[model samples]
Target: VYNISKEDGANICQWEYWGGNGQKFILEPVKEIEGDVNADGALSVIDVILLQKWLLAVPDAELTDWKAADLCEDNIINVFDLHLLKRMLLEQ
Candidate 1:
């Protein structure tokens, strides 16, 4: 299979799997889902919970993609985003 080299400026070539991070990669573009704060490829209650925890400053709580939580497109995550996310979830 084709493998990507870890060394900078190295060329990609056929290589056996060594179970490294560079061994595999996505060739297609990934579409980010709005409100998918946890970035598990879907919007759900779990994402809401994560966002909530992150906003409340819960230790160790992290958002996979903070931009996804910016429902207002204002480059900020806040109560407004949470409100909109809840509304979107309810609509779905």
Candidate 2:
């Protein structure tokens, strides 16, 4: 837990670009597919278990396809991502 000293909010910034001169934005390739953490061509309890294990720093529990596991697209695997995975599994 954390205690706040005084301020209860923070500021955010946004940027807009009107035009560019022959410049392009390149996107990094995503993982093989979404939610196939173990690369078994499917999403199952084992996939969730493997992802959880990876997050827990379990040896050899590495995610075969991290892009798929990073369902939130935040470039990180966290509890929120875990929740997304669960929702997907439930929906199936």
Candidate 3:
């Protein structure tokens, strides 16, 4: 079972039955990828491809966690984020 609450006093409760066909869940904090601007687990050519897609305005719900990609901590993910990621990778 899981309960989600918002700051406005609204809440939602949901439960999953214990069965092979039932849903499963894994909870974890968003990781700080060393230089993966696209947050796909690693900094690689794939990350660059994903970033290019995002820059072209692709609709990706997974990339909504801007904090993981906002490498500069400027509160917005754009070319600057990519630059920061590049810098981090170069430093390594």
Instruction: Single out the weakest 10-residue window by summed lDDT for candidate 2.
Output: 1-10
lDDT of 3 by residue, 1-92 (tens): 23333234444345655543224444579667755655567777666566667767877724634566777777777898777666666676
Q: Which is the leading candidate under TM-score? A: 1
Q: Which stretch of 10 consecutive residues in model 3 shows the poorest summed lDDT?
A: 1-10
Candidates sorted by lDDT, best first = 1, 2, 3
Q: Higher-lDDT candidate among 1 and 2?
A: 1
Question: How high is each candidate's TM-score?
Answer: 0.73, 0.63, 0.49
Q: Model 2 residue 71 lDDT?
A: 93
The predictions' CA RMSDs to the true structure, in order, are 7.5, 16.0, 9.7
Give the poorly placed runs of model 2, Cα more than 4 Å off.
1-32
Deviation in angstroms for 41 in model 3?
3.2
lDDT of 1 by residue, 1-92 (tens): 23445555566776676887766665668899999998999999998899899999999999989999999999989999999999999999
